[model samples]
Target chain A: MSDKKISKIKIGIINLKTNNLYSIYNAIKNIGYNVSIVETNTKYLNYDFLILPGVGSYAKGMKNITENNFNKRLIDFILPGEKKILGICLGMQLLFENSNEFKMTKGLGLIKGKVKKFKFIQKTIIPHIGWNSVVLNNKMNYFKSSLINKKFYFVHSYVCEPADINYCGTKTFYGNKYFCSSIIQKNIIGTQFHPEKSGKAGINLLKSLLK
Target chain B: MRFIRIIPKLDIKNGQLIKGINLEGLRVLGNPFEFAKNYYESGADEILYLDNVATLYGTNNLSKFVSKTVKNIFIPVTVGGGIRNIKDVEMMLSSGADRICINSSAIDDINIIKKTSRIYGSSTICSIIEVVKIKNKYLITKSNGRDIVNKDPLEWAKKLEQFGTGEIILTCVNHEGLRNGFDIPLINKISRNIKVPVIAHGGAGNFQQVLEVIKKTKISGVAIASLFHYGLVPKFKFKKNRIGNFNYLDRVKNLNIKHTNNLKKLKLFLKSNNINVR
Candidate 1:
């Protein structure tokens, strides 16, 4: 007989993206935790844990969340801190108070940071493309290696600046040394670099997060 | 840093290399093999082929075409157009082509990306993205810009990355054959969103435009068709500052996502299996 009541870990995901999150969906599936896309299945936000993924501008993500009635529900989900929440990219910024992306928009404010735009690294580039070393800020989880080492994929013109060092977990270089590549404040976890985009390391990181 | 590649695209149709007014050339250019040879000798890292008729005709039999081109050149080759199955993937790899680009198929069935990447390895699964200038934003297209998928290129790109796609070939349909400039906004956004290598194509009117697109997007590869046609200008005229490509991005991903497992055990298993794919 199949194990139907085998105490399955519930995962609710908010795919606040215009595209698919199947990479993460498949990665998490490999670990045996059945996860569902919350946006598609309206009950996604109510799961034991949730993942917030945003793929475009901060303004668009924020607008979509609010316009779709996802913001209030999301706030309610995290207010208790009983459930583990992970944010990727613009999702990570959304965990902060506000973002300076296209316009000054209010974020979820679960963490005390505001996303800011990058100054000209003109000769270098605008979007900080490719992998760069992430300097651990002292609270990075799933980081078994040294902080100064380990490159991850980062793609953003704006970055999150946490008000307190307690929330900032890693930082990378571009034009300005902005903070909040990865952040953790209790059950709330956020990563500016897409672990999903990071290949084997990304898959492994997702495995660790599930645990 | 690995040498950043400069690529030029030559879309094939009925055996003739074609470019149009927007993808519009108003006529057939020449043999793709001739262009491929010229590009390879001129230092193009690789070449991309979009079968303009694949979606229209519903078959991607570029294996024969690829084999012929490979016979004449010595470098990686990427083929796109009606690629929808594993058999099609094998055809390209067996013919010595390094990668395959999927558009309509990928959107219709995301599993095509996962299955192909799983079997052939993600390195050979390139996705051809045709971004159209729609309502002040970009949308993806298929079959000579007939059907448009409302999905944002950035969002689709990230999802493809998750599916273990090897690379992204971002062709701005709005800019294709226009020779005005590379779609800087689309290039920047998509490159930022997807972690794998991105090759920006279409609208490279000059070598300076090539340098400018690379500097702006930091794409792993900058592709041009017009730049080659304009002249075989050798040295890069843009600023010397190097931007990070997917090579470094892979490093960051290595640390963050792979979980904190027993390093010795994982390394030992990998070494013993001889499964190194880097």
Candidate 2:
């Protein structure tokens, strides 16, 4: 008669300074998810959920992740069992094969495709800063049903697209809107904005993830 | 994703946004607050409100001015000028400034960088060095380069990074009014040495200069004075590097241009071609 499906969720945050994990950190904690922070050097990946925040140059950030052996450890933690990892901004870009920020830096190949710089259609700013709403190709449990077309904060020069189109759950815009934004490739799901700075839509999205 | 900042520098006399042609070319544009709001809505990351009154008065405490700018801009706002002591720093942060940019004091006491950074999480304080070359050697200056200090700009910059400041905003004193371009070597030096992001300010007369900065130096962002202020857009050329492919350019030429609203067209052009010519 007892279903262990109703278990407490444990979240772990990467203690890096990119502010990539910041908004989601605040969002998860505010929603009462048990969260802890661990550095790449330390072994603390054992959690129900993992978060990685991103900022700055992709080539440099990836180097830090690789040089410190943080990359291999991340792949090890995610491939086994049912685990959910959220990569914000540059963190989202890192999930791809390579990025073109400073140069063609290698990224985690958990998802397919390379992160490319935004080329505007109209004179849309290259980085695509500010609020833009996302359109869902199909629906997922993580997207709040009432929150469709809700605007969220986006502040990055590059965007993430899954190697496969099946991974793209929802797509947002800047100049050219393409690829995986809110990806649902099985257990892994990620967003490109900070929930802490993103007002209500981000909060709602976080609520869905926690639920 | 890349978040580029288009910051408007407001030369504050007492506590107002003043715009001018050269450093000496000062005139009141409008209320600093009104201008900050307009720019924020138009997509400016933050505002840099520098005090012009410190030279007039012997004191360099700009606490009152920082308060006014923070009150005006709902987003993160940074204030510089006359920030000498811990008390002044405390006053600025409490008054609602997202960051405090230190100019003169930073050159004299790099330890203040460690002190303030320890107290305010590094991101809150920016060590600004205004440099001008005397003979062959670059001399660090205070009071808007009125008081020259005996220190190499590059060495002092590296020392400040050891002090643990979050970021450095370096302005080329020689290039300040010239509008030729950002001192690429200096940006490369500071950005290479500092663990935090370095923002190049002062010269950026054209798009080539901006591309030059990104190509020559691995800086996080660039701060414009004459370029953005004069309503000129930078046209860039892309170059492939070992680290990443960046937009690089050499000469800077000033020209009149208009801002366009075509994200689709811009993306198409960026994809089809490597160069961005305005």
Candidate 3:
């Protein structure tokens, strides 16, 4: 997490046909790193980190991965290979145990969490969109000192509730409650917010991910 | 609260970027993609592209414009104008738009808002509530201020929040393109009452006006058009200097004006004014 030299950072973006991967792909590439669009169902593992970028329903996203047999390759790389993975939005939800988006759909189970809809006490907006501040649960060297209080772009109806509080990397308040905006455990990290679309702060966060 | 978002609202009609006074007397600008890229590089927080004629024309090729912008601009892009149903929402999102702004269509059927929020989430949808002050009352207007709805603006704001919209773009049609400053009372009323973030748009002529609106109202962001497009506020400028080599404003058969403070300068002004920005 220190200010180590960023060199030879080979990142593979697992492209699921259902999601829009352009912003994230360009964000990473613009940072002067080697990024390849690893199409679904490929056995490509010659990379440092794998990014699962997703949109659309959780069921459809997972179906796209399983249908193309991409889930097997992903599980293999993350488990035995111990390679790091970053899941965004629906991709992040896919890292959980299950989601009730459309129905009870199984996820990658990389993180022990469940995606639940926002339950508001008073009248509130469903999709907690726009720029909102996130409180960091634990400090990480990858982020600058001033990064914690800055607002990050968030657009989601459901949030991931991690089973272990320690896994909650950052939390944001929306719909009258605080929910996990991101979770980190070992090499597996997931964010409900879209870092690629979050502008400069988001770009900085993505750049910091490069080892 | 974090930094106040500064969004450059691009009004597109028939595939080309255009500017107008009170959403009428349209004048063509330049390429939207280029404008978006310039704004992104100049530190714009987000880009809002309003398809000014989508609802009137009943066409849906805005996705193409959105796709082109998405390729180069990395900031969040919110595409509005003529978004009628869930299909239009899906098309925009798929075309690389981060969020969809709904206006007349949401008023026609509240169910669409609920349905879209259910499927895509509320954050993906932004409700544009345009208002016109008529005799001490703020009434809702639709179809780009051509049609006036009977509901009160406050009541409509409350309804949109109840319908599960992620954000609200409260544009004062009366003040839009006027450079007379924002309708602070209207913005304060809705923003204070609504739980979701309210993006205050229209009547923002310069950086100081933007700061005044932010200090006066509890708005989350400011959406600007002519102020950013022409640089100096057209009305505020006393000098009659011609702008653009090709008379860009007159291309759409409009007045001649110079482009002044670009997005970069506006951000600097905001920063100097102690207003936090991206």
DockQ scores for all predicted structures: 0.02, 0.04, 0.41
Question: What DockQ would you assign to candidate 3?
Answer: 0.41
What digit string (tens of lDDT, one per residue) describes model 1 on residues A1-211? 1345322667866766432254456456655668887873263366777888655556666766786677878888888988889997778888899987646889888999788876654444444544556777674646644334555556555678899987777777665445568888888888887665454456567766766
Query: Mind giving the per-residue lDDT tens digits that candidate 2 earns over A47-91?
Result: 778887665457656766776788888888888748888876777
lDDT of 1: 0.66
Predicted structure with the largest TM-score when compared to the true one: 3
lDDT of 2 by residue, B110-156 (tens): 77887776554455567788777778677787777677788887787
Q: Which runs in model 3 stand beyond 4 Å of their true positions?
A: A1-18, A32-48, A56-73, A98-106, A116-128, A132-139, A142-151, A170-180, B1-3, B135-137, B232-259, B265-276
The docking category that best describes candidate 3 is acceptable
> Which window of 10 residues has the lowest lDDT sum in candidate 3 chain B?
B235-244
TM-score of candidate 2 against the unseen true structure: 0.52
Question: How many backbone clashes can be found in candidate 3?
Answer: 3
lDDT of 1 by residue, B36-96 (tens): 7666554444577768777789977677777777554544567888887877766666564
What lDDT is obtained when candidate 3 is compared to the true structure?
0.78
By lDDT, the better pick of 1 and 3 is 3
Question: What CA RMSD would you report for each candidate?
Answer: 16.7, 14.3, 5.2
